[model samples]
Target: MKLVLAIAPDRFRDEELFVPQKAFADAGVETVIASTKTGTCEGMLGGAAEATTTFVEVAPEAYDGIVIAGGIGSQDFLWGNNDLIRLVQTFAKDGKVVAAICLSPVVLARAGVLKGKSATVFNSPASVSEIRRGGATLTDRDVVVDGKVVTANGPFASKAFAASVLSVLSPISP
Candidate 1:
């Protein structure tokens, strides 16, 4: 089965986390929630759900793709995470899809994954600079699909973000 892994932090935007989770689940993909610690994760949109699993470390090779949900927590972890950066870089280098939305792209860029690829995020020029500095094509849109790397904007783009992920994972029957 195609494993859709959501690397959810302890605090992320509600729609950013759950919308894509629900999308992957509805698409018949086996979804797994990987958090910093194994337990219930608090969402920014006033929702709470327990993570199915937690890992102190992630190799990024076991899953078909990794979606790093973004919010305040992601911003906090955006930089200075050598491990997470290495993980995202490794996943992308292996030709595996690695996606991030909102501020998480800042993390992805810091990991050197977004360099030269088109992507989107939730923040402003400073955030785009982070990705651009990594050599990525930063876009101010709801969803940007540059190769296997997909990214979305903010909470308002939740539906489009989920649809973009679905489209990337599996295009329509038509």
Candidate 2:
């Protein structure tokens, strides 16, 4: 079975994490949630989930892909995290699927992987500026897939974003 590592801020978006996790589960893929620190993570919408490990503990070579869950906290916690950025870079270097939704795509932009890639993020002047600075072409689509990197606008596109990740990681679409 394929395995994926999901990295989220302590305050991740509830749907961004849960929706993709469920889709991966139903497709027979295993997912492990990680954060800057392990243990409980609260969602922006008040939902809670446990992070099985910390980002520093993850080995990029062991997983088929990486998914970044987004929320308001993502701006404060994830955007400039060096460890998470390294993980994203490792995944991209290894040609693994790299995905992010909402504001979290800025992490990919900050990691310098979104350069020249067409991707979408929750439209905000800040986010659009960041991605464009990193050389990405901003799009208005709900979900944009460029190579193995997938990006979505927000919670509304969570299901489709997860499906897109699955299709990239698996032979069959979920």
Clashes of each: 3, 0
lDDT of 2 at 102: 95
lDDT of 2 by residue, 88-137 (tens): 99989988899999999999999999999999999888999998998999
lDDT of 1 by residue, 79-134 (tens): 55666677677778877777888878887888878777888888777776787888
lDDT of 2 at 132: 93
| Clash-forming residue pairs, model 1 | 115-135, 116-135, 116-136
TM-score of 1: 0.86
Whole-model lDDT, model 2: 0.87
lDDT per model vs. reference: 0.72, 0.87
TM-score of each: 0.86, 0.94
Error of 2 at 1 (Å): 4.0
